[model samples]
Target: MDSSAKPILVTGGTGYVGGRLIPRLLAGGHRVRALARSPERLHCRPWGGHARLEIAAGDALDRDAFVRAARGCGAAYYLIHSMNAHKGRFADADRRAADNMVAAARQNHLSRIIYLGGLGQQNHEALSHHLKSRHEVERILQAGPAPVTNLRAAMILGSGSASFEMLRYLVDRLPVMITPRWVRTPCQPIAIGNVLDYLQGCLGVDQTVGQTFDIGGPDILTYRDLIHMYAREAGLRQRLIIPVPVLTPWLSAKWVHLVTPVPASIAQPLAEGLSIPVVCRDHRIRNLVPVTIMDARQTIRNALARIRQEQVDTCWFDGGGSLPPEWTTCGDADYAGGTVLGGAHRIVLEGDARLVWSTVRTIGGKNGWYFAQSLWRLRGLLDRMVGGPGLRRGRRHPSDLRVGDGLDFWRVIALDPPKRLLLLAEMKTPGDALLEFMISPQGTDKVELKMISRFLPRGLAGILYWYALLPTHRWLFEGMLRAVARKTGLPVTHGPEKAAMTSALECRL
Candidate 1:
């Protein structure tokens, strides 16, 4: 690695693979230039705001954006595709995106392009739309001037990845699942961490530069085996998986959508794609990248650990309202009695705890809460009329907030510097309302943030207020995180709708 060479451009820096890859690139002593249509959506991401990372505000499909981002970079990582777009046009969109990246790389004189494509090959008669598109993208990229390094991977079992989460939700929620017969289809999955290792190792591997490698973990297992493996590790019962051949991919997808948060578009195509075997046919890259690959069981455990921690790396919602609220804890907790109704995201941002706290405290004042302003005001007014602080009085400062500052209808009852802030609702409706924000340094520069919103309903009013506002609250919190990522310029690869978004890998069948 030449220190004097220009930085690397990572398109889809906000995506699943890209999210994990950015950190590696930075850690490898390479400067990172990330392309995103909305860089703000990444503030909550792990690589969001490192000094080594330069976010290039642009979309992959935008020719100008792509050209500008790729200019002078030693290498470019292409990790994006759209299988969730308008009906029947996903492949076209993928081709166009590929064309854009190729043209940009050519015009910008990029040294190399590394792309992670789907692993399994298919006969033309049996190929699915999603896989075809993936293959097409690879071909398009290879035809360009830059030497394209394409790593074909199966399911990536990690936090926020689609195949991993879909399996996780199915296993966690159901003791028995009516799975399609495709459960027996063989596939290989790589741990997220191992995949990152391979990606980082490729940066200087000249032999891998112009090659296509099948990347997977050490073991090959049927989807059923994966379910059992995850179940045993999770300490759950071996799920009674009723595999029926009659259930078409479309029907199976519908089943997944109704039962899990995965959208129908992602599920259906994924279900159809499942009929094919996804086992890795080669181990050439592993020899070169040389990572200690995690087994399927371990991969599932790691994924569950992250999901339970609520630091999911992708969005799993079907294209609709914002993603649902999910949470993960760090090192400590006892469940207290209260109606818990808000989504919590636990992130380890690299900064002093105090700095992170100051950033949070300044939120929700003159700068406004990240999500819904009208909704917040309406709720604040209702609180104010009921003898609450309401929206009448704002916070003391837009940037400098104290522990006891009055923030609209909310009061800062408890404030622990660089560690915690507790807010007690001055509103009159609920029996008692509490919002606690806690931040602790994971390391010298990493801060772990936990926000807990607890409300004890008094009677009818509280219940009505909570239920009526539940839908909006879900969207708001989810979007608020995105807004936070955007505002703070955080580096996140994937998120809330991770499962849904990644579901396209399945549709390629």
Candidate 2:
């Protein structure tokens, strides 16, 4: 793409929406510059490798970085919102960021600016702090020298978004939940993909400039209805959600902290805001852009499917290209072989891990390995000569796995619903090997799964065997995780899933 065709500069590109949006910019044949606090931390899945996308270090808060990055750009996308991370004064932060953007855009003589804001009727007094902050940011942007295209959005139902992730974690952890009247409130839910469509559409529409749009998913339903829709689509029974009129936002926030993965800092404002209904009142965006809308249930199904297929192009949390950790609550051992491994994420769903392990554990005589049956039989044959269980023991469960079950040349050592699974290798090796599986919740129902393959080298031969297999580890490990995520879940990519990821920060944002 030519530099002149590059229509705009994108802020919060390291954010959930930005993470996913940058690619569309490239696809639209526009040259783009993305703002990041740490350029080195910028990890773009689809566009990371694209030459059209440039990562420029900048924080919306840091006037210098903001101004410097915005200069010489044709336009700017003010997609950065401070609600999840900045507390109490997120509005103030929003204002400052907006001011900096305005100043920089004006100084750079940019032609236009596009921003994504929350939707609500401000005149009707229907606005939460989140919405209010969004509105405030819009006003600041519009008053600037550049024409502004503001798209106000409703509940986004995609993977990595803060709100989406919060709801997802809450539902998965608490099969039964206490009541909160806010959940009964009505709102509009938009698919993350659809939102991206509008956002990318903003790049070309001259009518969009100086106008505001209210964006939403295809379905308009109460919060509870949305929840029910998500639950049904996730292949689970209707989740138990009890709403109490008496639970104030403050109290409810603490309750949310206990149930969901969202930290109190974000949950407080978000929970309080839930009291206000969020829906698109105008059909402005519909008139301006041509696109298809997805119902609540279909949105849920597609979002989950995307994660399971490892097709989630990006994540809100890991958007900054940050290195995420894999957690295990003990029982990860270094076996006598030369491998290192861990378990699966706990709260996040391993849509396929549960099924894969279930099938692999029933190996022996005829069952064989669910995937690599030949290798399993060969290992078993070698194990038999080495006086190992081989394939003779079969398994305690033909299809189900337990703490003591035996599979071909491995025995189940640890088992936990969702979080973990451990297997001790009984194969003919110079030493022992332990396989630990762990999965972690990342940006809603998405999971970060880590498979640990640990082996302690017995001696020189043991070391050689393990070292010889070291190169194999990369392919096997990457392929295994990718396969599991294809079955497990990737970060939610489109719509609300593309919303910012909120961590359960003990400290305020």
lDDT of 1 by residue, 1-509 (tens): 44236888888776667766788788778889888765644443546678888888776668888888877777888888764622568887788889999899889788888898886665646667788788889989999999999888777777656676577778889998877888998888788888788878888777898998888888888889988998898899889988876887777776665555454567666766667887777788877878787888777777777756655544332111211112112222322343444435455565566656666777765677767888887877565444344564455346544333456556554455557666656556555656666666675656566555555566778878777756665466556656665666645344433111111111100
The whole-model lDDT of each prediction reads 0.68, 0.64
Per-candidate total of colliding backbone pairs = 34, 45
Cα lDDT tens digits for candidate 2, 1-509 = 33356546888876668878888888878878888764533442434667777778777888888778876688788888875533567778888989999988878888888898887777656457777878888888889899898887777777656577677767766778776888887788888889899988877777887887888876778878867777877767888888877888777766665554344556676775667777777887787888887777887787777766645544433432111112221333332123432222122233344453443333343555334445556766565554444664444334445343445456554556555666667556775566666544555334545556656556778878877877656555544444443432343232111111122111100
Query: Would you give me the overall lDDT of model 1?
Result: 0.68
Q: What are the models' TM-scores?
A: 0.64, 0.62
Q: Which stretches of candidate 2 lie over 4 Å from their true place?
A: 1-4, 43-46, 123-126, 319-509
Residue 348 in model 2: lDDT: 29
